[model samples]
Target: MSKPVYLGKLTLFWCSSCKVPVLDGKCACGQKTEKMTITPPGDIRPAFPYDVNRINEVSRKQFGADMIRPDEIVLYNKAPYEDRMEEIICGGVILGTIRFETEKTEWVLMPRIEGARRICNTKTFTPEKMKSGELKNLIVLNDDAVPYVAEGTSVLVPGIYDVSDNISAEDEVIIITKKGEVVAAGRAKMSSEEMRNEPRGKAAKLRWKGTPADETSPEYRDDAESGFFSAPRTWDDVIAANRNILDTFERRSIDFIRNTAGNMDKRVTCSYSGGKDSLVTLCLTNKALDDFDILFSDTGLEFDETLENVRKVAEIYGKPFRTTSAGNAFWEGWEINGPPSVDNRWCNKMCKLTPITALIEDNYAENGCLTFIGQRKYESLARAKSERVWRSQAVPNQIGAAPIQDWTALHVWLYIFREKLPYNPLYEKGFDRIGCWLCPAASLADFMNLRITHPAYMAGLDEKLRPYAEDKGNPEEWIRYGFWRFGKLPPFMQHIAEAKGIITGNPAADAPAEKTGE
Candidate 1:
């Protein structure tokens, strides 16, 4: 976690002509692209309809409008944070970022002008010009305040701001000049009523400073001024935009598989995870070689949909299908090592590696199969720096190769959509990354969604977890806030737990519960 993960020399680009993101400088439409300044490790992903809706829902709550239109194609780059945060991209410019605050279980929008302008209008009420109630977070400052705020200074009360009726202390506000230019976006230190009545404190703590002159894109600036963003589009439009790039990338991946298969001294096999990445890898492997097996490791906790997808993929490819299961190992490990946490994933050794290692040793002996995994660099720092072809020191018998190591999530998804592959329905249902149902690495938002959609599974997990929290605090609060995921609570979590009287200190190290519940 200490080491920074960079996606290497590769940088992400936004294609204005195609209305989508492209991996290279030149877009499929033969138009030059704008380089996106995304935060590292820049493993950006296309925001799905579900993700889009959720973001818009958050924006609507704060700004009284949706920052991203459902019809617009948008991409999100993950940012460093305690919980979930993503930098939203649209119209070849940064719209803003939307993040989930773990303590509040709330989604907050940290807008740039591209996003703030969509929901805010800085007009005063005239017969021809009127301020909409929907533009409720606006703070208009006098002429004296504009230049100072433009310099990234916080809005001071002495500037004599005229604030919107809905402005409340701690509410996110869009600071604009009397002339209607957006100056900054910040959190309110004083409510609208307080700002009007009082005279000597910071009015708003500015988080993002904005000036039209600071932006390089004249077209984007024009669009912002005229409100020209968010035209109607579909997923098909996205695919069409990246069609040329996809075909070229596909050919390269196919060639990689062929070369890796041809050179391997042992048998070549494709590992299937029933995820979009693996699906593309399997398709490439099928095209690359005539003889190979599709291997799957069922870790007892896998969803039935995932299991079905595995079977369907193998059947479609007309390849040999082989699977091994660690049927009761996870449950047994739970009794010994406790539930798997982000820091300590004892579950991986038991459920995946042990079964796979055993299968590789028994079937292929010493010179193990050359397994092609659907590994992508953008997934993590380690994976980003990982070599395409290598052997894990832990499982030296097996040789692993990644054909799509450089692919972004968008690349994998577009490939899946173009090929009309039978992907897991869970993605459409809002599961972005497919894995075990109870993966601790997932945010609390994921589990809350599961509580409603998969009640039986959630209820089962809660039953096991509730008993452990009985002596700690309100069992319901502990579960509701996702206190069970951490073996050692991070500082932010520790702060929340202490405030809630959930526990006096880190509970995991304090005492070990006999049996456990990620």
Candidate 2:
């Protein structure tokens, strides 16, 4: 069979020495000028000519009529569609018309329909540019330096020495500079620890370009000694830093609670997870407001320590703490629907949303209420894009306010410091989130930490997932995928890792565990 011939525009160079197309790997122009080739979609000239309407119908069925943008065009061969191209076509193609969203539009030469001829392609076009932003509140590294980063600066690898919290991909974030100037901001391509540890690749893809520092927005004004990066330390320093952090946190937290109470309706509560964020949020919320409720959604997959911690937090706060489970119904739901994917997360619906919705419906009983959340904009891009206060369309008549929406991870820790709030033991042991024992959002390092610190929890995860893996007829893929994801199998199950040891050490699979405890 003949090799598949790629039909496209061929460059012909008229060399004074050898007048011909630039063929045979040599240019006719004794000067040896290089030639380039370009191809457009859809074979204009084909041996097997099919109806144009059929192609249009298929394209429309697969992609919406607007699948291809007006600014773009499509390319195709005789073969079936390429998967990558299919995505691009659906997301980025148009017809022969090219539109320009930016200035500096220019004209270029396009190949004529036949005979290697060229014509002036009177088209104006622009490349796609995406923008994002983050807000940076001044955070003190020590007694010395106060740093400021703005809402829209690229977070490079070298800029960050330590992370403030357990942020995930696609979460909104606020960026502050080491010198106290808020830099540019955008969605994080990687997490906080991922930015600190990963040596290569673009750490956070900058959405909005930052304004340069000037007299109005000074650059690097903070004293070097005061900055936290000035003195990096091991686990032992956490206790010493507590005093400084707590002092600052207590005052701000009190203010935050008061402001939240004043701004929202009577019904407010904390989204308690027994982790550092929610714990701090609960303590601070209670301090500021009177008779606020705490809602704890038991995903039915929480670590034993997390459950205990919930009890402890509730007892200490002296507030009514409620528990709602995913129940057998959720388990049965998963059985019918199969596992949830990254985009399609029904678990959040079954476990997190349903319980909260039920509670609001039963307790509020048609009364208008407001809920306070511990969500910080720095947690993710989706969160960052959100407003500080918004009405929940899902839950009618309830307003949601994230009092600490603009705060950074470091700020949360500062609250823990000043108030001397009781935190989940897992934070000391290096677990960032203390929700479900096997949360899909955890990083690889988080999973491994679970293995070393909480082996029994790992065992539970393995047992729970085993049946699902078997039902899928690809037990190995299922086991290996979730194991390396967040919930680590116990050390005893190291053989499981060894048996199908093919997948490990991947950034997608694991990261270096953050050291929080001795």
Candidate 3:
């Protein structure tokens, strides 16, 4: 499994007077604020294509139709040192998040109020809103049931006061007290009528309970602050704010490169992956050394945008681009070894490492090259603990060093923006990392977006997995859920499949045949 990317705890404060997220206890417009936590149904996943459509669909299905406005801008925010999780901000508040879970699935977790707004909030199934089909999923509790229905406690059927007419089992719901306070958010265990009439059984499973933050008391409005929601407007402003830090990083990286290369007798090269990190590395290497070549491993699975970007960067820098082809190696390996999984990454060996090794040997075998790669500690635990310089056993006579190992993703973006560098266009299109187009390590959201932007690629992938799935007695859901990408289902996925009564086939039988030609 890939290393877990840490997501920092997110907190949002509401300025009731300004009706906007405020950066400090006092807003720019000068309004007192109170803390408010909007908890979503699941962990936040990465934003995918047609996000508005998906949000609308969930609203209409779970609450009511025509709830969220089309003009609401979705802002993706990342915390310091955290790259795996992205918070989804709308209307100056973090209403939801896209989180990459341990199972490698990205889920969008939206708060109850956010869900209500998306579905047209009716203020807890009010008689008037009921006629207009608002508050479609709600659980009303009697006065006596409020305290017992705390976070993590299941709501019982007996103390039910009233409920929305359209509620269904497993529907996301806001649980309200008899006095009209939205005390908790949960999933309904039974339909509306069942929850109202049943004498015994759980009615709803509470996800979060009301806290002091949720209290309507007037005295608690002076101690809250919103962080990034009220950040500066322009990219230049952001760069300017961090200019000192950027300069420090730039100086340190340049020195590291100079010192490392000055002691080595071998040729110097930058392992250009065409991603933001590699691009930044290339810039720093140029500043440190006058003569260095570019080594690009064309895995054949690279995005068309990335291939073009490699050429563009090489041309601008006037460096000799040494390309090593992995032509059809990924497909050939997949055919012989089954689809590559996090556990079995033969595809990387075959398509990336093998070709790059040969390229080094064929060109610079006389003297090994010192390669600068764009790797950051924030990327993973393995990379976090890695040395500034090291030699890999997989490749002979080559030393690797990372200059920007301590920088964050935010720092990289700031530098790139300040320099006005032409980055890969895919990042603007919502791709976080650019690598093999069909990399199994990719999140489900990536594949979902790929399906929209590149249907033929998804079709080709499904075509390859269908036969393998069918032979193993696995249902089409195995392929649909991207389970085929993993040799063994991780704990989270296994639990999910079990809950849904989906059976995953035995992995031993699905193992591929012997290796083919290298």
Q: Please list the C-alpha lDDT of all candidates, in the order they appear.
A: 0.77, 0.45, 0.66
lDDT per residue as tens, model 1, 1-518 = 65555765445786766666777788778899888787777776778888889878877777666777767888888877887788888877778888878777777888886677666543322112214565567788888888889789889888855777767898888888765557888899998888888868888998888763322267455555445466666768878777888888899998998998888788889899888888889888887888998899898889888989888877888777778999988877766665566656667777877888887887788678899999998787688778999987766588889998888887888888888989998887767788899887888867877886688999988887776678565547787778878867889888888777776222443333333322
Off by over 4 Å in 2: 1-253, 263-265, 463-478, 483-518
lDDT tens readout by residue for model 2, 1-518: 33433322232222223322222234322345334232222221111112223233333321112112222122222121110111111111111111111111111111111100000000110111001112111111211211222333345555564343455665433343333332443456676567657885445554433332332323422311222011222212322323333444456767867886776546766778777777767777777777888877787767778888888888888877766776665566555544443324456667767776777777776665676777765445577678777888766666777766645444565456546777776665644346766556554445555667788876766776666556534345445445433234444234444555423221222222221100
In order of lDDT, best first, we have: 1, 3, 2
Question: Model 1's lDDT to the true fold?
Answer: 0.77
Clashes per candidate (backbone, < 3 Å): 0, 38, 7
TM-scores for the candidates:
0.89, 0.46, 0.75
Better of 1 and 3 by lDDT: 1
Model 2 C-alpha RMSD to native = 26.7
Who is ahead in TM-score, 2 or 3?
Answer: 3
Off by over 4 Å in 1: 1-4, 122-133, 178-181, 212-226, 473-475, 504-518
lDDT of 3 at 501: 53
Give candidate 3's total backbone clashes.
Answer: 7
